[model samples]
Target: MGTTRTIKNKHAANGSGIKGSKASKNGPVNDGVIKAKKNAGTRAPIPGSGVKGRPNLADILKKRKKRVYSEKELGLPQLNMVTPVGVQKPRGKKKGKVFVDDRESMATILAIVQAEKDGQIESKMIKARQMEEIREARRAEADKKESERKAKLEETKDSLRKKRKRPRAGGKTQDDDVNGFEAVKALAAEGTKAAKPKKKRVSFAAD
Candidate 1:
């Protein structure tokens, strides 16, 4: 039979399992922050310290900035460029006058322009003559109608005059007419002359 002897010993050091070596005062921290650390510093190294060839670990997080550009900074020209308040830029360049070097082409253009002007003038004269002829024809027709109206009026007047001068049926107007005082006296004198002297002549012849 064999008896085995085992002796156990207790350690006095901290048993923390964190990694990496302690760094400078303002160095980056990886194992979360110590709320109570304040401005205080720690000197104890982590249990599983240095990684052979690397420096102390750092966990850095930086914010990304948005890009900005001015009109001058833009690569292409900007049509919507805003002018600064109370400031005016220079005006655009003026256009130069164009000179024609070919005199033959210019002369041809002038001849075409003259032909167009002459055609327009002749057409206007012909239109004016046609309008005048139309007005003259209307006036002559109006004058003819007026002459016919006057002739009709004259015929009506002549017919009325003839109607007034024409004789009617009866012819014995003097005998059946009523006598005035002068006609009665003339008739009585003729009757007295015819009745008195003839009786005395008849008596002498009988004796």
Candidate 2:
């Protein structure tokens, strides 16, 4: 019994000591932790490191390059600078005036202002007599054409009614006058009498 107890203790000790022996020989160190600390320090200064203040409008405008244009530039009006697409500029007021661009619109407005300064009336009116004459002419033309068309339609209907009422060849007519059985019998008798020869009247002469 004492020898068996000693053998079981030796087996348990051998099993537990193997893992601790291997770990002592090749365990990992703290190099990975040190490297991670160094990386965190380098990344801390990267944020908010560039362009720290508000932008100056004057400085930006001064730094922008200026575009050169000659006196006779293509597709541009002589007086006004050309705006980019989708930018709408204000125009001046004038009667019967249209604008191709800002310059032309401004010119038209100035002309209207000058005219108003000279105390000219800007509104125009149509003559009442001319308007009445035009209205009367249109009414007369419409009435004449309408009457002519109605007459033509009525004539066409009348001709159609006449054609419908007319009798065809070898067909019965309303004027033929044979309507009932009595009229038919009378006609038959008259036809027979006319077809027969008439007898001459015999006269006895006294000597």
Q: Which candidate has the highest TM-score of all? A: 1
Query: Per-residue lDDT of 1-207 in model 2, one digit per residue for the tens?
Result: 444333433343333334333543322222222223223544522331223232342232112211112212333454347777656554554645654678878899889899886654333224566778899999999999999999999999887555433422222344244344443443455457754311210110000
| Candidate 2: residue 109 lDDT (0-100) | 85
State the lDDT at 57 in candidate 2.
Answer: 23
Structure candidate 1, residue pairs in collision: none
lDDT of 1: 0.40
User: What 10-residue stretch in candidate 2 is worst by lDDT?
Assistant: 198-207
Local accuracy of candidate 1 as per-residue lDDT tens digits, 1-207: 011100000000000102121323332243223211211223212221343222232111100000111322445433448778656544574556656679998998899999999999999999999999999999999999999999999998787545322211231233124334433343444356756433432332222
* C-alpha lDDT (0 to 100) for residue 116 of candidate 1: 100
Model 1 lDDT at residue 131: 96
Scored by lDDT, the top model is: 2
